[model samples]
Target: MKNVLIISGHPDLQNSIANKTILDEVATALPNAKIRKLDELYPNFNIDVASEQAELLNADVIVWQFPLSWYSMPALMKKWLDDVFLHGFSHGSTAKLGGKKLIVSFTTGAPAVAYQHDAVMKHTVDEFCYQFETTAILCGLDLQPIVYTNGVSYSARQTAEQIAGQKDLAKEHAKRLITAIQAA
Candidate 1:
């Protein structure tokens, strides 16, 4: 079985509508995949570096799933990256994370249209997510396109529409990630 690790980074765990839906669907579809709720595990923001590295060392694919806050990751997720992805463990000499595939699934607080250069958000989705993708590349890991949804201004109707669309999107993305994992 392919080992997949899901790192959820949403601060408000209870109210993440889109993120939870996608993760649940992934878990159901890929029952063998390991789901690691980072926030729940490290609420005090103290990450066990060795243990986290061990988890990363065992996974074929690592997924960073989170909601965009202030155009970046939540403080704890950034801290997790800082703490867990150490010099020797993830990218340096030891290179524990090398050869692992990386996928970033994220949600934004703005409408999709607003991500355009001329739009209110003033930047494209890909541009906004360069840091995460670059990190994977630097670690010698294959990277996938970042999945994003505009959650900020979405109304009930819009949310329902997006929710309906998310099922297929999530499955497709999961299939792509899984295929890569198996191939690796």
Candidate 2:
């Protein structure tokens, strides 16, 4: 099995329902995968660049797991990319991250239908992710198809039974993520 690295970018993991559920399921399903909770690691947003680079270098498959905030990743995740993906290491002649597999998995408060062109957001999730895809291309990483869980906010004010159903949905998404990782 390939070494898998999960970079979890949830800002408030404790209060999260979908992200936390998905993470728990992934951890249980793939015991060998290394998970780094970015917010926990850098609460003050002070990233240890060398350590982050080391983790990336050691893994074959890298998963960026987060809750979509304002149609993008959390602030710390953007900072992580800025700090760890340096010119020489992630790109340029000395690039060490070339050929690594990259998978982006995220939870969105908005329903999938909201991302349709004629819907409220007026754009698809994939359309909002062009920057990430371009980053993978520039870094020479093999970008995998995105995995996302939508309608998460719909469960916010739900009853106990409804919340349980949301958890089940997260579990299913986690299973799909595991399948994607296995394929990678």
Candidate 3:
């Protein structure tokens, strides 16, 4: 079996509905997968670079799971990347993270209609995934097709029924991600 490492980049999984549900389903589906919850580990934002690098070294499949925030990943995950993915460690000639599969799985607050060239958001989900593709290229990681779902946002103002619907969408997203991981 491949060593699957899922990095939960949600700033606060406990406060989350869609992200948390997706994670729970993934955990239940892939019991052998190693999940690293950033918020729970580093509330103070002090990332352990060595440990993270070690995890990267050990993993065959790496998944970055998070919610769409400000057109990018959560600040905590960005910090973790900056601290752990050093030039020589994640890239450059001496790097060892090449060829591992990277699957970017995320949910957007807005619906699918918003992510289009002529739509309100003015860009497609694939456009947003360019950065991940570039990262994988630079690091020599084998970038896999991204698994994403939109309109999964949840808010306190939402009705219980609406929240339940969003949770169901999150479960579907998890299943798609699991399929990608299994293929990887």
Candidate 4:
């Protein structure tokens, strides 16, 4: 069995509903997969570079799960990338992380309609995923089709029914993500 490493980039997963549900479902589905919760692991923003690199090296598949922040990954996850994916390790020289499968999975606050060409955001989520594509290419990782769930925001949803509905959506999102990971 190939080792699967799931990196949870949600800054504070405990405070989340959709994201937390997604991760919980994923963990249950892929029992052997290592899900690293960034918030719990590094609350002070000081990342253990060596440990993170070691996790990367041991994985055949890497899944990045987070709530989309400013059209990109959260600040903590970004810092992790900066501090861990260094030259001679991830990109240059040894290229230790080469050939690993990378899955970018995230949830967004906005609805699907808002991501269209003529919508409020003015571009699709895939367009915003260019940075992830670049990262995959630079690291020599095989990037998979992204798993994105739209309109799962708690702020946009205010009722008990709405929250429950989003939770159900999150479960479906997890199933879709699991299928994608299995295929990859």
Candidate number with greatest lDDT: 4
Cα displacement (Å) at residue 12, model 1: 2.0
Please give the distance, in angstroms, between residue 132's alpha carbon in candidate 2 and its true position after superposition: 1.4
Q: What lDDT tens digits, residue by residue, belong to model 2 across residues 1-184? A: 7999999999888887888999999999899999999989999999999999999999999999999988888899989989999999999989999899999999888889899999999999989999889999999999998899887875463788768867887898899899999999
Query: Which residue pairs show collisions in model 2?
Result: none
> Which residue pairs collide, candidate 3?
none
Candidate 1 vs candidate 2, lDDT winner: 2
Give RMSD to native, each candidate.
Answer: 3.0, 1.2, 1.1, 0.8
User: What is the per-residue lDDT of model 4 for residues 1-184, given as tens digits with 9 covering 90 to 100?
Assistant: 8899999999999989889999999999999999999999999999999999999999999999999999999999999999999999999878899999999999999999999999999999999999999999999999999999999876866888888989999999999999988988
Native-referenced Cα lDDT, model 2: 0.91
Of 1 and 4, the candidate ahead on lDDT is 4
Alpha-carbon runs more than 4 Å astray in model 1:
152-184
Please provide the root mean square deviation of candidate 2 (C-alpha atoms, Å): 1.2
Model 1 per-residue lDDT tens digits across residues 133-167: 78987787888656666643235335566756654
TM-score of each: 0.83, 0.96, 0.97, 0.98
- Candidate 1 has a TM-score of 0.83
Model 3, residue 57: what's the lDDT? 99
Q: lDDT score, residue 5, model 2?
A: 99
Error of 3 at 17 (Å): 0.9
TM-score for model 4?
Answer: 0.98
